[model samples]
Target: MFSCYYCNFCKNRKTTGPFTQIPNPKSVLILPKKKKKNRAAHQYHLHLSSVAAGRQPSPLRRPLSPASSVIGAHHRCVPVKLLLPPSPAFTTVVAFSAPAFSRRGPTSFQISALKPEEEAASVAKAQKLRALQTQFFSFHHNKIYTKEAVELSAKLLEINPESYTPWNYRKLAVEHYLSQPDCNPDSIKSVLDDELRVVENALRQNFKSYGAWHHRKWVISKGHSSIDNELRLLDKFQKADSRNFHAWNYRRFVAESMKRSEQDELKYTEDMIYKNFSNYSAWHNRSVLLSALFEKKAEGFLSKEKVLPEEYEFIHQAIFTDPDDQSGWFYHLWLLDQTVTTDSPLLASSWPAHGYDVLLVEERCYNVTVECGFNKNEDLLWKPLSASNSQTARVWVAHLKIPSSDLHSTVEVSVGHSKGIISTRGFEYSHPSMFSFKVHVQPMERDFSQVSVAESISLREENFMIYGTQSEESIINSFNQLSIKNGHESTASNWRSEALAKEIECFRELKIGKLTLARLLMACDVMSYPFANKLVHSEEVLELYSDLMKLDPTHYQYYKDEHSMVLLQKVTSSKESLLQHCFQYKDSVSSAICGPICLRLNNLSLSRMGAFEKLLWVQMLDLSDNELQSIEGLEAMQLISCLSLRNNKLRSLTALEPLRKLKLLRVLDISYNEIGDHSIDTTRYLCSSPLSHSVGSESNKDETVTSDVALIDNWEAFYIFKDFNLNQLDIVGNTIADEKFKSVLVKIVPKLKQLDGKLLG
Candidate 1:
């Protein structure tokens, strides 16, 4: 038997006997006395044996009486069988007072029995929140501009700061408050300050909150906060997280608003970089500020001559400290690009090498109007020799109506502001009645007389020394002796070229930044020197790209593209290649066709087509059997008519979008490609299945079922070929080359006379 204190309603005050076990017990009812607080009343019952009812009761061993109003007092244990009511809503807290489980005080356990009242309270709370949202939205929708509405918005926004609508409503409310007749600057400031406080609280919860940040900007724009305070706040935010781009952008906005000098901002960025070199945002900001300073030539800032070297040194230190960091490397490349200057597009050469009726300008030009002495008009219409109807082309052709009077005179041709004179005396009149003449405009001759023999020898010797070639020294000396005999002048050495050579050597010795070294070599060779000079480091650049492909296999394709670009540049830059292969090629009849220039570049394994500006003259190109996956650069071949992309890795027809401008394209060979089979027949069959029964039943009726067929005709291939008037197309050996595709191809290209090498009857 457990000994414990009984309830106050017990009959005996003192202990009498040991607790006795009853065989069967009757139920004893107990009720809680009403409290002055008017709490919910509850009735409890206890069961006791019939034998215990007749026994003398002990204080510690007595069963709870039926009229017991109170449970055991504090620190008491009552051993009684609890019987709950049948009502589902009955709820109570059952507390157990017992001896200490350890050295602690008496262990009390509570069973939290939930009540109807607590559940009701929870439901009321949710209802209140919903009502608050409804009221806030009602005010927003109705455009309510009252003090109460603003307070209500604040209440909602405090719970969810990211809610943009509430922030907007607050802005509207502030505007309404300012528009009041009695609204003074002090009052306006007070309202805005409170709004700023709300935004600040939201920022404290989530520093990157976009709505809070935007609201802060709006508040500052309204002349509520001082620039110093805003900057200090931004400083705090940036100090917490240096890479916060939003904070940086806002800081720039603040600086712009105040018209602060970029020089000060430059110092600030330097400080940020010093604190953390890995901060790309700081580096980017520094680049912008420095570029602006150079452009403006701002006083007290580093001059253009001094700034580049200093920045280079700064970035060099950064990269050397951390080789794997990309920030410093990117900035360094930018600085290098800035140092290199690109030459403007000039008239490279012209075709018809003598006097001719048809004139071809061998450089990309737009809005070409030519003024010639042969033509009566001041400007004759010259069209781009482009089959794609492009605005620009390397070869611009014009058929001049040359008058008989000007045939013997020197014909002056003017393209834009630049003018060139062609002697009509050299023209041979093949057709005297038609007035056909051939005029060739050759490039101006370079003056080699000014070149110094001694400087040439010294430069060659320096180059040879860098290469460490003893055999080439004798050859160079012989060349120098020839130059001396030919009577050339003396000049100073090219210090810039020597400096680049030294830098290249230094980078080679360091053996780091292979990509950087490769780019530097390219800039030194291609950009640093004039077009007439030979590229000294082209071979080394190509070798570096090859090494990079192996070293960084993840960017292998990128390196391969770069290698292709360099190779194409070398080929295009050659005088012989440009004149002989590109321009002077003739048809089988040994006569120059006035049509598009044809270039046979097949089997070159070219993944990318570089030097687009140089090859814009080409109209008929054979690019078959290579690693070409996409025809992106082919659009630049605006004059192309016949294009063969057979046995390539073209996977999608969408890659043909670049060729959409090639309106003159007729003969196309896309055979053996990987284009997917998005057959129109399949789509038609799927869409027509539901209408088949209807057609069969309504065979006698006049209802047409061509809607599904019409829908199926809008495939991608149809769209790509809709504007095309192709006469010959070969799509054989591809997955898309089914019989249905062949039938659709005939419909898509209505002018087609041949498909897949077979005549489309």
Candidate 2:
């Protein structure tokens, strides 16, 4: 039964707590009205059997098990203030709905979450060593739990009840501990006593450390305790800050604990309602309570046990009376769902096996799974779930629709193995490689939450087939169409001799900007090395550090560019320099200039780059025809991300990287390259991906010396991967994808999400 008392702010008024109504006048009518005479029949052994259509209770009573002993379940999340007690972490009470698929059968989710060991010393030591982070991550990945941890923690707190650290540590440590799996047989009784004592200690200790008190209440409320103490830990933290949310939250926790054991929950419920009915947090707590009651009542209905059919009706009446009260709704749902499903965690590698309830804790994420049990050969569909108390549930339906095509099959999976099925007929192309850096080389890959996680395998590029530019190819065939269109037949020879001149002009202008190549590089983006190496003579590309430096005056032994100072250290041979540079400021250049740098930087090594890259690999290269047309795949390469085809007779824009994702390509001076407007216009592939930022690599150098950051000489339009510029789109080296500039035909352009030149043309 549930009820909602009146509130002025019912609409804007967020409510809490689970308030179920007790049975009243509406209930008795369902019974035989031998009325006054039958009342005499209720007198003896027929007590509970009265509802069974007449059965007698066995006089023998059984003792309750220590672990399964019920304090009863609350269907809704209690208000933060009541259930958790107000604390800094108890920000506000908010209701969330769980995904509908959270039901499952007998199989518990196999999780590798660890149970942490206890020790006042270890708690402090672990925090200091950052072992908790490491250990948590380790267990999270492996899905293993430890029983020693649960026993050790539960035991340590009993010895020193007032120690808040171990108590809290124990709380975090036991998150994944299932009752039977983690419980220690030898210490079960002592552990229960210790938990109660901790709560008692928390109440005794000025009764105000909200963190300590709230934690204790949660521990005791799990139903392992018979004692419930509610006290005000007066100004526990000495009012260094009076509005401490943590302390205030704890006060709320103690209030909810009072309801742990109640023969008549209404009296306590009324007291709580009157205590601070206006306190929304408390109201939220009430909602969870009501929800739990609803679930219990539902269990009775399912079992043919002692149940009040009319009483179930009363729960509905309360829900209608106060539509916004969470407690009532939660309880009503609980009674409805108990037989339907068990709360199960998701099969992802990131989330915990426990913590599936959102309102159950202050968390950022949750995982849920759902399963449908059926007779053999029946299709899995059509199940009922009108009732349940879940705030954060994610359901994974075990049974699913058959594939529309005869391409693949679905099989049950669990931990210790992964989804490895692949078919030639059905495959998704966009999924990233499932390589992991972990020691195991499992044949299957994890596709769930593990994408873009911290566990992917690290692969470096291994081989190359770099080729260089040959002399400018025949002018007539390359420039035929463009020459006729622009009336530039007279200037055809003129443009062929001018590409290097433009490169020289751009370099000389940077000098006029009062910055050398070093200063410019310090401010370079992904183009740092490629732009600088372009300035170096090509013959010196293979020169060793000492040998090349002795022969070239233009070459320095070593100098910092716009990367990290650590990068410099990594490039060097001296270990002492590496260590010394670590302590310097990130603001200044550290090393003196020295180097005979590689000048023969070429393109053969580049075709095989990875999804991610550092600027060190950039170099000048020629793309003649290692199967070349457009450089579309090189979109992310700002300097190398660009390509030059002065000699190749390319015909279409298909060879270019989608321009939308490249912000670093500034020099599209394919002046002497072969191309014509007849090919296509430049709007094929575009995107909104984040572009690389211009990092001052010189500043990245050890701060022992100072260097200024300067970049582009005469370019005003810089491309960050996010912003797309059409004017910078150059199809000079190749024929446009279309013969008639089809991109301009559309009257109003739709936002370009994706454009394949072949399709657009």
Each model's TM-score, in the order given?
Answer: 0.60, 0.21
Q: Could you give candidate 2's per-residue lDDT for residues 536-566 as a string of tens digits?
A: 3211212222232242212121211111121
- Candidate 2, after superposition: displacement of residue 50 in Å? 51
Which parts of model 2 have CA positions greater than 4 angstroms off? Answer: 1-164, 168-211, 214-263, 297-761
Give me the runs in candidate 1 sitting further than 4 Å from their true place.
1-188, 222-225, 300-303, 342-503, 528-530, 533-535, 575-587, 591-598, 677-715
**720, model 2: CA deviation in Å?**
20
Tell me the lDDT of model 1 at 644. 75
lDDT per prediction? Answer: 0.52, 0.27
> What is the C-alpha lDDT profile of model 1 across 495-553, one tens digit per residue?
43454565578678877777778777876764422233345677888888788667454
Residue 124 lDDT in model 2?
Answer: 76
